[model samples]
Target: MPQPESQNQPIAGRYELLEEIDHGGMGSVWRGYDAVLDRPVAVKLIRQQSVTSPELAEEFVKRFKREARITARIQHPGVPQVYDAVLDESYEQLFLVMELVDGISLRSYVQPTQLLPVSWAAAVTAQVATVLSHAHAVPVIHRDLKPGNILISHDGTVKVLDFGIAAILRSDVTKLTATGTPLGTHQYMAPEQVRGGRTSPQTDLYALGCILHELLSGRLLFTADSEYMVMYQHVNAAPTPLRQLRPDVPTALEDLVLHLLRKAPEARPADVQEVYERLEPFLPSPGAQVSAPGQAGPAGVPDPTSIFRKPYAPRARAGQQSAAGQAAESATAQPAPPVPDAVRAAIKVAYSRSDALLEDDRFAQAAEVIGEVIEPAALALGSESRQVLELRMNRAAIWLLGGDYRAALPELDALSDAYARTSGPSSERARACRAQAARCRAELGQVTDALAALRDVLDVVRSVDGDVSEEAVELRRDIGMLFLAQGRTTEAHNILEPLHADLCLVLGPDDEMTSEIAEVLAVIRLDLDGPPS
Candidate 1:
């Protein structure tokens, strides 16, 4: 199969493939950028290995497009929005563009040393059940519902992935294997599924039971050396009670798992709703304390129960102040002896190298070039020397350009404070730094604070330079785009409509800035009002 030749190459002339997210037997996924949409997206590229002949190829394309369309029909927050599906002209590759979900998978939460708390397990299972209910209602059976296929997003929303993908991939696998073995997750497969029987909502329930059991027991429900052995266990073996492994497990909860693991599809819970109901007793109620000692997952893992505890809560802002930011706040920059000639020359060389690297779109390497001289330069000319601070700012900018927002955010925050300390808060350097930090915040998904920061900067800009000035225009445009990102379309349209008119008046309708704003306004108008009659 043909692979992407360049790391930064745009796929099909629109989706710029940045970094590889993951790879599997089928193909790989990329953290891609949509040039047209100006947003980050997850792109799954399907390889052509399954299509052995032209006839199979044509059918593959038809089935792939149909599955993509049906997957998009699942209108739930738990389902990542499918933005587009692109089949390459050569039929060599297919791309599924989807909303980028930033979260730890349940696989990460499964640790033999620390099984999840009862509430945590229940919270995750309940959320998945809710998502399953939505998918099944659309008559979409997730033929392969496994822990890896589920994601707990940062905001604690449980997202189900690849709804129609299993059905498509199963056919491909069966054709290749020519073995009659069923093609679902062996550990989570229902007895009927193991027998190559028809799957339904009950199959999904069986998978959910497997997930819940693993979450509570920190082990697969059935384990063996080979896929065939695991499949056989699913069909014939009886599962051990959860309490036997973890006596703290409630008897009722254990019973629920046994009921779900029943060999027959008809013997399982009636539907996902029933599974959700059974899980409710172990879930944290609204406003209830979500954690107890030993209840937390691995450090840095988000609390899934936060959704029920504070339903519909805005994403908790990223760390307001990293440790370095705090130190920068408490310690003042002290003047030191003049820098030596050799150190200054090294700093200059580093800057030249970084500038060249950046020109070639080698952002990470560019940041590294700057980083190499920062410590030596700081040692020779005080830590907060103009030369050292300049290097820090440039590196941080490179990180932001590279889409390393987490690395850029804290540095930008500290840079803003440092600039304000040296130059007054209203000075050009300080305001500019603050504005850049706000942009970092926006990219990091702290929309509320980011919007507030940008507005503050805009107010300062308008007071000095009029609202139509270059900086003011850019800030206004950014605020409108931010609002649009948050799904406040009417507000976004209200902000951008007048802004577009102003851009046209000042820069003319054909100007690049004016045209970009006009394009966004066109999209917003289309969303607010239906398509033309």
Candidate 2:
């Protein structure tokens, strides 16, 4: 075994590495500070604990450097900005200084809070989407976003903690596959990704769906007590309904969450922004607002056009072996139907310990452990308790990751209702339900209805949460994405750029949002600047 290095030692004379904060297959994080800047910072030291060969170690350092450089390019309100990356003496280690987030992982939050009220769960997810959008904007994909990587501050500020597995979508493809790193979380992997296929914005969307499910349920979405079982489930099993577990969930919103849980990548929403937009309405208060009696002129049926654009299923890649691969894959890999009581209970217990399996990137193990818990728990425990609501959310999220969006919807709706009662109309819980509902509608080609649903919350959201928080920024970003998807390039640009600019100013140039907005702009350029108007 490699001996642990002494805490509080100086590395490169620039950063004082304090206590060990965390360790991954890639590196160890430490509570450290910059001697020059004087502000405390967290330093992640890339592990050189073992190398199959000394030659590989040299190659490892180079790969790590290349990866670090790509990470440094990211900027987002919800992602830690890396300030420095360097090699230590004898070039034994590589360390990166990142903004220290003063809170626990989302995992910790779920355990103690267990089944966060719906709005709050949506809030966490929205912030995550904000981070993802930004990361993807650099055209970089956070191939490994999970609960542990999501950090929430004491005051509720959130940041995504690692860039280790971030994949740059640039021409530098050589760097990613060079060391043959088997990147990403298994349970959260999109169907295309799971099949060792192409990746796009939709890949991250699948992961977020899983993460969102976990946060809402305090549970994992897939399980069978083994990695293979979990991977098999992700590839083949259908998820249990979220509402059946959480009886209080609203039907409309739950429908949306399940849509994200679809089994085929092409069946899932085209991008993460779509998820955010769909979910935003449910994030607001549930009580409908009456337009103050006889209020003003021209109050025709609400403009359904504003909230959503059509959400066609994502087209399979051009060179894909079959143009109807999505249909064929779905037909061939139909998921396992919900099983009996005995089987369900066993699965739930297995899925609850996902964190234990995360280190080895045995995401399949973690997922299986988590997924198995859902069905049995719903059977053994009444669906109305806090526990059930939590389980439902998790199951729905897994369904989302599996590309079983239809299955996830019911759970999201159920969660919204429970949160409405638990946290009340004014809280973030209520808002999550509204937002998630919108996301589902948008994904299902109910763009008009999706926007309308989102519009339904505008009044309540504005009243309760008010404008200008990160939550508000995320909502705006969602709308921007909706516009872009519909080819309303100018409209999308106008809404997103200013918000993007604001994120840059408040969070700095390296924030995740900075990259997300830029990426959106890049897409707009390709879609609008070079195409038929």
Candidate 3:
């Protein structure tokens, strides 16, 4: 451990030391003030050792310089900006100056009793993916990515810390760490990494997997009485699936986690881009409500998902009085021109085009076409008219299909309300709309509310249609998935086991739905049995 420097002393005659922010085996980090630049900075001072020989000191200097160079090469917002690396005349002390990040380390957020929301965990992982993507492009492997090295900023931006052990994948530089010893946190090391084998971008993915699993389950991926045991588990033991511990975790997400934890580096997702794509469905869309709205953990604690939930959404430009006046003027001015017959026909053509585009997987173009008709259709026909409502509903469905849940969720809620009024609350369309909204909620990590809404819908469907009806059966399956997500495996098994039997009788075992239910049953059984030895 390095002793703290005198508070009044300034390193390199520029960075004025203030107070210690953190200390680890490597060095001490201080909250510093740049006297010349008149700005705050984080100063990391490498611990000085009384080496008996010059060779050890020279080796330390090379490692220190390598860390600074590798970290600087990673040009990303998720990484703290490296300002300077200072070596004194006698080489007794080393210092690294960097941007002062006002945030808490992710280690503080890990709790045994309280797990983070699924979206929050996914969002953090996604940001880390973005960071890793940038770092890997520079051919730098983090080698160590534990919770302690991840910081959630005050604005909810995730900043990956500590590239002190990062390895620059260049043909020229020799291997840094000793050949026999692995370099990473025991709980998060990939099998290849634990075996002291070559590491690549996939090693970082493996570490991220452990972090995400911990975030969702509120516990480490593998915990043991000794570090050696934990390392052994990383190499030889299979991870307990997140869904087994926290049922509210989506099956898709659990599968992603498992893929990331694959023992072989090649078995993981091909790149960070693939990991980010996998995480997209679980990330909250712009303006989407978070699972725990308004309550972002303890006061002053940042919500990691805020970036995804409200990414640069501009506030209303008009002032309060100007907005009110504009609204009143619009209410009186909107009935001026009538939509022509040609325009109505064009709108119909647009809807047809959108449907075709949707089939081609051109979601953005499909959405654009549907959006183009919405205003014209609403203006010609009343906003509440069947044609306009149908157009809006179709647009919402497109948004949902595109995975733009922020836009889809509000539209679904409004459509549900509109259908309840126009077509009676008991109407199949209204029930279907509400059920779709519940699914959106579930995807957004509002599991409890989604489960409740699903139950209510299921009750209504069962009351009107029979238990064996297709709609009721589908609802039961959705409910079972929610139960599985919430970690209620017994309940999920109980519900899905019977539902699978019914599907076989009604839809036959060959049906897609039956096959899907069968897969879920297999997963549940595996969870019950524990991982294969």
Measured by lDDT, the strongest candidate is 3
Model 2, span 167-268: residue lDDT tens: 677675544455553467676766666666666677777677777666555667775787667767777877666676565556665665567677776788
List candidate 1 segments past 4 Å from native: 5-9, 166-181, 291-294, 318-413, 420-428, 431-533
What is the TM-score (0 to 1) of candidate 3?
Answer: 0.57
Clash-forming residue pairs, model 3: 247-485, 247-486, 247-487, 248-485, 248-486
Stronger candidate by lDDT (1 vs 3): 3
Q: Which of the numbered candidates is closest to the native, going by highest TM-score?
A: 1
Q: What is the lDDT of residue 82 in candidate 2?
A: 78
Clashes of each: 0, 77, 5
Estimate the TM-score for candidate 2.
0.51
304: Cα error in model 3, Å: 1.7
> Which digits, one per residue and each the tens of the lDDT, describe model 3 over residues 1-533?
43455447778887877678887656789887665665678988877753335776776678778889889999999999999998765667788999989777888778878767777788889999999999999888898899888998766889998886787886644455552467787878888877777788999999999999998889999889998899899988899988889887899999999999998889999998999999999887787765456334433356777787778644322122223234434665454435568557977798888878677666655776788777767777777888878888888888788787766777888888999999988789889889998998998888998899988988998889988897899899999999998889999999999999999998899999999999999999888646576
Worst 10 residues of 3 by lDDT: 316-325
Residue range 389-484, candidate 1, lDDT tens digits: 899999998998889888787788787788778876777767777888899888877898999999999998989898999888989999999999
lDDT of each: 0.80, 0.64, 0.81
Candidate ranking (lDDT, best to worst)? 3, 1, 2
Worst lDDT 10-window in candidate 1? 168-177
